[model samples]
Target: MTDMQVQRHAPIREQVANILRDAIVDQRLTPGQLLVERELCEMTSASRASVREALRQLQAEGLVESHNGRGTSVTVISTATARHVYQVRSSLEGLAARLFAEHASDQDRAAFRAAVTELAEETAKGADAAALLKAKSRAYDVLFRGCGNPVLHQTVQTLQHRVTRLRALTLAQEGRAERSADEVTAIADAVDARDGEAAQAAAMTHVEEAARVMLAAAEGPPSH
Candidate 1:
């Protein structure tokens, strides 16, 4: 109730929310995995109130759904939602690429180059799925930051969180690692060249490839 009490507990709620969100995104929780408040409190080392509040916030974010006696569970994403999220992500990433190309400062460009190098090294080392995903996410986060558009950056981040599971699956598929490495290299080259058009094209291409891979996987193996 006091300002200090509220401020002190805010981070606990945020930490719980992030942990749950990452689990959902990684499919570790799976669709409809029961989230008992007491279990979460133990798992997160937080009080029941903090865990409950975190679950409530995730529900508001469309990442979880509460069912009276059944308790809360991760939400299953529909194809319609998937398509809409990809559409929005593609548009926003394209804008981000354009902005980054046009407005990246020298420091921003250096940071992007370093991120790209790290991603490339990780991919070449044949890192596991988890490592690859983190590297890939970091690279894009840098790109979004370099774009200098707060609203656009936030929108892409929100959409990314919603579809993180699907994206992880796509990134884990055969040949996707190599393809993603190539895409990242292309985007970096475009930005280095300061070519907005090329950056946009590369960024869209990367996203479209991901969309195609996800759709194909969703459709299951070719008939026969």
Candidate 2:
């Protein structure tokens, strides 16, 4: 391949990192699955250096860990740990919603509405997990843009990799996707109406419901 193809958008390393990240997020790379540099290089059609850098980026995002001798693998998420993540996420998301309601500009509100609409369209079509994840990401971008606090936005971003799987899980459950769509509608309405408290409550409710569904699935069937 030519250099133009290799570095089409950014760099080969960044491209590799994004691909690996999406794989991990979609649960194609299951937790505790080892990441071999040579294997990843072949799988991604990237060089060893690009593969290594990609792995390093995933580690920094908390999606993978490099063990002492076992090499790098996807990080596992226990139910309890997932609960804590959702708990903290609910609060953080509430703050973002509140800030967005109070400070979002006309263009921000328009973008937020458009994202919600696109997500709803995809959800109605019974979109696959990867499609839903991408649509959800678009909605999140609107929220982050509208929210006034950059620091708070970045803090949530740091934890996003961990919850990516949870999002997939939540949407996979029957009826959860519909409810989540309604919750986004409520949030968008509140933000457009400039009702901070309503926006915060809607966001909190959304997070809590999703967490409950995801954690219950994580707990799984009881041992005999």
Candidate 3:
């Protein structure tokens, strides 16, 4: 194929993967929802090859499962997976916080402060779920990028994608917005103070709270 054709089709595979990943994260696909190749191809307006390649990538990422006769479906988020994800996330985010405290320039800190202010404003607006998610995502992106730790940034990026669905679900729980906003503020304060330990502590607490919220939701409503 020509260079233009190859470049054009590359985005198709990525687009397909993102749509499927979002569906899985939002729980629209759910665990074990069949990801039929023909259906996905039609839904994404891509060729069968692109859809198949996207599915293969998702499967490699542990977001999808495939079997000989059963076809592909969204992978179940087992307790083990949840724990492992949180463990890795905590370490990476903590490292990010520490690095930001130790190495971030004044300008970087200023940018982070602005991002935090924006997050606070967005949260106070009481926007819809999607808006809040986007705002929080942007805020975290700023934080990670400011850390000056490439490895930590990349690791958290992967973890964020893997747990996107859980994060969205947790955001739906009662009091999550308030809690998240408060944590964000705390993290900002710690980083601004240039206290690596405090920043790491704040970040770890924030993630732990999120994990608790997600686990509680996963357990379903309380019994009387």
Candidate 4:
């Protein structure tokens, strides 16, 4: 079926949720921006039921918050919260890298290398944030698949979605993209060489760098 038809045939709430999630992550719906139910329905051409259901899902994901009188708004990640999130992410990613190094077959390693190359090329070409997010996700897909832990993979996916906005912010910082690409290359190199310890360290380093950039950007420049 065509994409449009597929959307119509699928569960309406998920379709609406995906559209709203993309908007929030892409910053079209900025942090602290109010989510008006009527406006969302109008924008997505979905019904009230679908919009409300979608908002409920996003609220559960920590991407949207609702106050009794104030309604819902995109979540704003404070520096402290970002730091905590990164701490958890670093540990989980370290475990993932070590596991991948231990478990990845030749074919899996080849796919991981291909994903790294695609991400590097995209970064060098100065791809937009959305394109870069997709490319980065492709690389993570290889890691997730090779790691051999469904529970860990699913947990990381949830956490990744929660931090998508912060991640996009980090990617926008000056020189951050090149640095991030290099970090991923380091992780890939360690995995290729079958050094589990080095791979884990490389993955942790990448998360640490991302946390640094994201926290600094979230804080904004200090006033003179």
Pairs with steric clashes in candidate 3: 25-165
As for candidate 1, its clashing pairs are none
Estimate the TM-score of every prediction: 0.89, 0.92, 0.87, 0.93
Best by lDDT: 4
10-116: candidate 4 lDDT, tens digit per residue: 78899888888888998889989998888887777789888999999999999999998779999987778889999998999999999998888989989998999
Top candidate (TM-score): 4
- What is the alpha-carbon lDDT for the whole of candidate 2? 0.86
When summed lDDT is taken over every stretch of 10 residues in candidate 2, the lowest stretch is 1-10
Candidate 2 segments whose C-alpha is farther than 4 A from its true place: 1-9, 221-224
- Provide the overall lDDT of each model, using Cα atoms, as 2-decimal numbers: 0.81, 0.86, 0.80, 0.88
Which stretches in model 3 have alpha-carbon errors above 4 Å? Answer: 1-10
Model 1 Cα lDDT, one tens digit per residue, 127-196: 8777877887888888898799998887776666675677777877998988888898899999999999
The TM-score ranking, best first, is 4, 2, 1, 3
Q: After superposition, how far is residue 224 of candidate 1 from its true place, in Å?
A: 2.0
Ranking by lDDT: 4, 2, 1, 3
- How would you encode candidate 3's per-residue C-alpha lDDT over 30-66 as one tens digit per residue? 7878887877766667788988898998988889988
Model 4 CA lDDT for position 112: 92
Cα deviation of 175 in candidate 3 (Å)?
Answer: 1.2
Clashing pairs for model 4 are none
